[model samples]
Target: MKQVLSGAITMLAGHPVAPSTVYRLLAKAGWRKIVPRPSHPKRSGWSRRLKSSPRR
Candidate 1:
């Protein structure tokens, strides 16, 4: 996000933008940090097991 914003600022304003400034601006815009979660173990194997299991 910071890199993209920095590039955009550099392109538009002819100056680099600080990461802290980008984060601060996003915070003011009500954006929150997101953490990605790994897929659930059972769900991951469901399709594989279904394919390998004997057909009814």
Candidate 2:
């Protein structure tokens, strides 16, 4: 948030939307949290571990 706000502030003073604010607004709008996929999960051994791991 601070980063975004800072960027906005740098670009235009007065009221500025910070990066954090954008995330907050998205959350309010029911946006899901983004999770990056594990890198090459299909080709990694970690994928097998994930499949074998018991659910919590």
Candidate 3:
């Protein structure tokens, strides 16, 4: 998010913006941080295998 925000700010303002500035702007815009749910590596293939297996 910081990288994307920095790039956008640089393009719009002709300068690099810091991560804190990005967070501040987002907060002002009523945006909050979101953490993605944890994923299990072993479960990755389970759904594919179940779908491809014979319906016995």
Candidate 4:
């Protein structure tokens, strides 16, 4: 959240918009906060985690 806010501030530095205003604009544009969770009903996290493990 902080990284996104910081980038917005840098991009709109010359403007008089506040961080809150930038968030509002983003929301208006259909941006949403995504909560991490299984994208499918049958997707198990343990198998995915094991597959992502570093090979030794």
lDDT of 4 by residue, 1-56 (tens): 74677576767786555677777877887989888774666879897788889988
* Top candidate, metric lDDT: 3
Q: Write the per-residue lDDT of candidate 2 for residues 1-56, one digit (tens) a residue.
A: 44754676557755766566667766787877669886665677877789889999
Give the higher-TM-score candidate: 1 or 3. 3
Those runs of model 4 whose alpha carbons end farther than 4 Å from true positions after fitting are: 1-13, 37-56
- TM-score per model over all chains: 0.48, 0.33, 0.52, 0.39
- lDDT assessment of candidate 2: 0.68
Instruction: Give the winner by TM-score: 3 or 4.
Output: 3
Question: lDDT, candidate 2, residue 3?
Answer: 72
**Can you write out model 1's per-residue Cα lDDT over 1-56, one digit (the tens) per residue?**
67887688668877777778778888898999888766555675778688789998
**Number of backbone-clashing residue pairs for each candidate, in the order shown:** 0, 4, 0, 0
Over 4 Å off, model 3: 35-56
Which scores better on TM-score, 1 or 2? 1
lDDT of 3 by residue, 1-56 (tens): 77888789878988777788888988898998788766655676878688789997
Full-model lDDT, candidate 3: 0.81
Task: State the displacement of the C-alpha of residue 5, model 1, in Å, after optimal TM-score superposition.
Answer: 1.8
